[model samples]
Target: MTEPMTADQARAVVYDAYTTGLPQAAAAKLLTGRATPAWVAHEYAALRRRGVSSMAGQQTLFDTEAAE
Candidate 1:
């Protein structure tokens, strides 16, 4: 059986999935053999709560810079 993924691994999956607009289920399937979409979704929420910016959020970067 595959070992469970670590928090860091989970974070990477969440980041990639979130930034690329992929579903949490896709992230789980791509990253961890044993991870679930629900778990990845939870990680994604946790990342947002921690103030990690997603690509969607970064869309404003160019606008903000142009305003300067």
Candidate 2:
């Protein structure tokens, strides 16, 4: 079996997915064995709370919606 992912690694994955416009729930599903949807949702909330500008210097769909 593969090793479990660290919290940081999971967060990074979630961040990358989120920046690509994937919803937190969908990203969580993608991490099936690595992280839970609840955990991913929490991390997503934290990112929103922190006002993360962007991972690739471009606003995400979610960001645009929030701005409108």
Candidate 3:
């Protein structure tokens, strides 16, 4: 069975896609098969859990439900 890709993996996928000239939306779709919401959240959460600076001031909310 294939291992699930983590947010870092997703980020790498995004980076590769962007460098390859893929549009942000299309690249995210093709690589992540999901929206940017959980990706950013998981990243930040993981970092904070590890006592690291995860996005911090750079955080952006892609999860509408989270704002509700």
lDDT of 2 by residue, 1-68 (tens): 78888888888888888677677778988899788788888888888788874454345444676687
Give the Å error, residue 26, model 3.
Answer: 1.7
Candidate of highest lDDT: 2
Superposition error at 30 for model 3 (Å): 1.3
lDDT scores of the candidates, listed in order: 0.71, 0.78, 0.52
Off by over 4 Å in 3: 32-68
Score residue 65 of candidate 3 by CA lDDT: 56
lDDT ranking from best candidate downward: 2, 1, 3
Q: Where is model 2 more than 4 Å wrong at Cα? A: 54-68
Task: List the lowest-lDDT window of 10 residues for candidate 2.
Answer: 53-62
* Model 3 Cα lDDT, one tens digit per residue, 40-59: 44543454567643332233
Q: How much RMSD separates candidate 1 from the native structure?
A: 4.9
Report clashes for each candidate as comma-separated counts.
0, 0, 0
Per-residue lDDT tens digits for candidate 1, residues 1-68, read 66777878777767867776666677777865557677887887887798766666346545676687
- Using TM-score as the yardstick, the better of models 2 and 3 is 2
Better of 1 and 3 by lDDT: 1
Q: Which of the two candidates, 1 or 2, achieves a greater TM-score against the reference? A: 2
CA RMSD, predictions in order: 4.9, 6.6, 13.0
